[model samples]
Target chain A: QQQVKQSPQSLIVQKGGISIINCAYENTAFDYFPWYQQFPGKGPALLIAIRPDVSEKKEGRFTISFNKSAKQFSLHIMDSQPGDSATYFCAASHRSNDYKLSFGAGTTVTVRA
Target chain B: GAGVSQSPSNKVTEKGKDVELRCDPISGHTALYWYRQSLGQGLEFLIYFQGNSAPDKSGLPSDRFSAERTGGSVSTLTIQRTQQEDSAVYLCASTLWGGEAFFGQGTRLTVV
Candidate 1:
């Protein structure tokens, strides 16, 4: 079963605009949510993460908005740039148990300059 | 010395052949993981190794797939009698305790 689901298989955003990607999960036990960015020929790197206790977390230009009741979370990139073009994945996991991550299918983002 | 490292960036093999992929986790990291990425697909969990704890093989797709971590540092994934559907990019990641994971470049395996 796909525990986590994401939308918009691909996204195109203009430079300096906002880029958004959304994800939802079915497992209520998941308490940690993280977003990863991956460029071609490279592994996915952690961009930002949020816990269920917080409503939102921001790091530099990247923000993660999480809704605990709804079991959903999203990543928003402010002032998008061409260098931000890459594939993004959302993942969820529980801390008490094994740290195996359940990932969304992924979204390919293109920031056009 | 600083990040997770994987060997054999690319491998092409005939069907029914066995293939082995290696991963070297960062120094002092206690958690290691393996994931698979198919074309246009998300990272699929394969296995995980924590300090001394039993490895979690629940995510493994089939019995033909197996993994082993030696000395709590390096890991090896072995695939027996590979099939075309097994072709994908294999990624390795390492983390300290329960912190964020660091990923390696990955190894692209193609089975004909």
Candidate 2:
């Protein structure tokens, strides 16, 4: 029962291009959404997060666009670089619901130079 | 010491045997989570512990899976009568409310 759904099992992008990954959920109670990045042999780390109150949030080359009505969200990587190659996972959680995060199947991004 | 730590980076056990995995969270982190990372399953939430309150075990796959945290610190995940399907990389993460979570390297478990 994966609450969050993610797309593009894997993608290959040219250097300096933009890589976009989309995610959707059915739980309206979810108020928080976060993206995690992981490299081989390492654990996933929090890359960015956004709350439903805000439509979007940007941190450096990463931006999160959230759509409350559609119960959808997306992560956009600007100027995709080789270093950005990793597995990206989208997760949803609500503060009132014990903060148990529901994760989507990951998307592996490969930025080729 | 500085980050979340998990033991026995790798483990292999016979089917029907029991195995225990350990996690030592960062100092003072109240939220601890256990997730299973399989080849295609991404990360599957297994259990959660928040401070001294009762652990949330809704995500546990079956009755053979159980966990407990001692003194609000170290935690352990135990699998009894292990089956081949139970083999997966077990990851542990720790975080505070509204903060970023820190994850360990994960223990790769193989039930033969």
DockQ of each: 0.90, 0.74
RMSD of each: 0.8, 1.0
Candidate 2 lDDT at A40 equals: 84
> What would the per-residue lDDT of candidate 1 be over residues B1-112, giving only the tens digit for each residue?
8889998999999999999999999999999999999999999999999999999998899999999999999999999999999999999999997799999999999999
Candidate 1 chain A lDDT trough over 10 residues, lowest sum: A93-102
Q: State which candidate has the highest DockQ.
A: 1
Q: Please give, for residues A5-111, the per-residue lDDT of candidate 1 as tens digits.
A: 99889999999999999999989989889999999999999999888989999999999999888898999999999999999999999987676888999999999
Best by TM-score: 1
Model 2 stretches astray by more than 4 angstroms: none
Question: Which clashing pairs does model 1 show?
Answer: none
Is model 1 an incorrect, acceptable, medium or high docking prediction?
high
Candidate 2 structure quality by residue, lDDT tens digits, B37-90 = 997667988999998999999889999999999999999999999999999999
**TM-score of candidate 1's chain B against its reference?**
0.98
TM-score of 2: 0.97
In model 2, how well does chain A match by TM-score? 0.98
